[model samples]
Target: MPFYTYMLHCSDGSYYTGHTDDLEQRISQHHAGNLGGYTKSRRPVRLVWSQEFGERYEALRAERQIKGWSRAKKEALIDRRWDELSRLARSQSQFTLRQAQGERVSIVADAFEAMQSAAQTAHPREACGLLLGEGDCITAALKTRNVHPSPETHFEIDPQALIDAYRSEREGGLRVMGYFHSHPTGSPSPSETDKAMAAHDGKIWAIVADDDVMFWADDKDGFHALSYDVGSG
Candidate 1:
């Protein structure tokens, strides 16, 4: 079919739903600075859920229904946990794990460099990657591409690559610490969409960059800059 619907799990962990005719091409536009709106400033969005339909009206109806769902309900949809969705529907509140503490400068710089290299290679749009590290020491950098960019930008990391890297790291006792992405023509600051997408847990550190870089830890104040060399412990 000519119609497609997609769900985006923003940095804040919230869900954004939309429909398009050209699934892959529409997502590219979102990341290429072509579609500028709510997701414009939120440059790097991840596709957590998607489905195809034969009709545009059906896709739109689905999107509207999903938009009104509770957070837990939305997450269940993203995770495809249909069973738990009903239980979550009865709960009044939700809780998420806390993100880990902030990291050191050396690690952040290493991540920035990796993202910069990706950007250069993918020029005109943007490049993305993940940094696997211990408490604060970067152990490995896994590079990926923004393969789908439309109603929003979605990343694609090689599963085998990530699995191999993770297994190797765990064998040595390290951890998959944080993630980083580049914005082709935007600022590093987290936009409203970023805040909405952010996971409450402090484990995920979102590093956004244009020409410059800004890193934000999960906190009530939202994303703030981590001075290039002032290591936060």
Candidate 2:
């Protein structure tokens, strides 16, 4: 039986590499997001590269090797540019490092301004909202009423607004990709309450503190700071 090493392009514009004996079934699991771990949340992953091996060990070794490669090297492999691969390998030590601020995720300028504006006026109190867009991009911000009892600190988005946004997504409107909230007196980093309350359901959270707004990816492991562009469109 042949084993395979495969690569998937995740929705966040990152890559996932794996080894499997059944390529078709493994990819199906990834698509279903049933495979879990890194690929679980970065769904709609599409298989971009795969190579069959006579033995499982060979496939495993290749998978391990590819996992350590830079994105450029991986893309070269996908495009089958062997010469470029060698050049990329050599360049890694000096110049091929992944950009510190990744361009994978994006939020529209209007959405960002809306969030900032809402938070500014709500100073001394918290502001909350929902992010609507498609596939790792936030195109709109739906400012929702904060219903938390202690408005100066905690914030809870109005439940009915959440329900309505979800209903709209079902009807082919913008997707509810994530949520946002303000940290009236501190940094945009997640607080203890956020860690405890957020579901870690693979949603992005935009946190605003003062004039600075930052993006975070909430996952089972923890909150990960994700660099994002505020696109103008």
Candidate 3:
């Protein structure tokens, strides 16, 4: 079974982090008022972020690490705001570098369309997917949805699906470059929780909209936005 470290944005604007093997079922329990305690009183929680790991240990470790963060920090992680996470992680690091420096970055036309389609399909909740790129140019996109309700809103990308995509991309000498997701009701900017969960380096985080797309790079300043074009080379 796959393990996940997830963050929940509670009704009171508080954040909760925990680990679960079955994200969908766990979130369902929370929503049904069956999963009591902290989240129970907070009611009407929403899943703001999640990450998949290969092992239980990794998931648990990430959970523990996130559970210790402040609410703002948790939001940064959920938003994949690397610079903010790094600032919290490295309070005194002087120099910072942006990830997409001079790389040939451009959103794929197909991926943008897929994102728009997914967003419309998952209205009132978030949508997510992976973006395939070659060097810095996005080549393709795959989208998915969270069938579960709030507090347990979880999305999954099948390993086989990923493998198949990887193989197809490799055949064309492309690579699984990064990931894209929508905030639904939230701004395209990265949240504090998002920063906490962002990868350390060399990763792309794209935020999609009904009309626009934004990219961020992990830097000393916490997820600084970079210039990007959607459906353009």
Best by TM-score: 2
Best by lDDT: 2
> What is the C-alpha local distance difference test score of each model?
0.58, 0.81, 0.65
Question: Least accurate stretch of 10 residues (summed lDDT) in model 1?
Answer: 92-101
Candidate 1 regions off by >4 Å?
Answer: 1-104, 108-111, 147-166, 204-208, 219-221, 230-233
For candidate 1, the clash count comes to 20
How many Å off is the CA of 89 in candidate 3? Answer: 35
Candidate 3 structure quality by residue, lDDT tens digits, 39-62: 676679898888899999888778
RMSD of each: 17.9, 15.6, 18.1
How far off is residue 176 in model 2, in Å?
A: 0.5
Estimated TM-score per prediction?
0.44, 0.57, 0.47
Tell me the deviation in Å of residue 40 in model 2: 44
Alpha-carbon lDDT of model 3: 0.65
What is the per-residue lDDT of model 1 for residues 124-151, given as tens digits with 9 covering 90 to 100? 5655566676665554456764554431
Error of 1 at 51 (Å): 57
> Which scores higher on lDDT, 1 or 3?
3
Q: 134-232, model 2: which lDDT tens digit per residue? A: 877789988899999998989999999999999999999999999999998878889999998989898889898765677788888878877565555
> What is the TM-score of candidate 3?
0.47
Each candidate's number of clashing pairs is 20, 0, 23
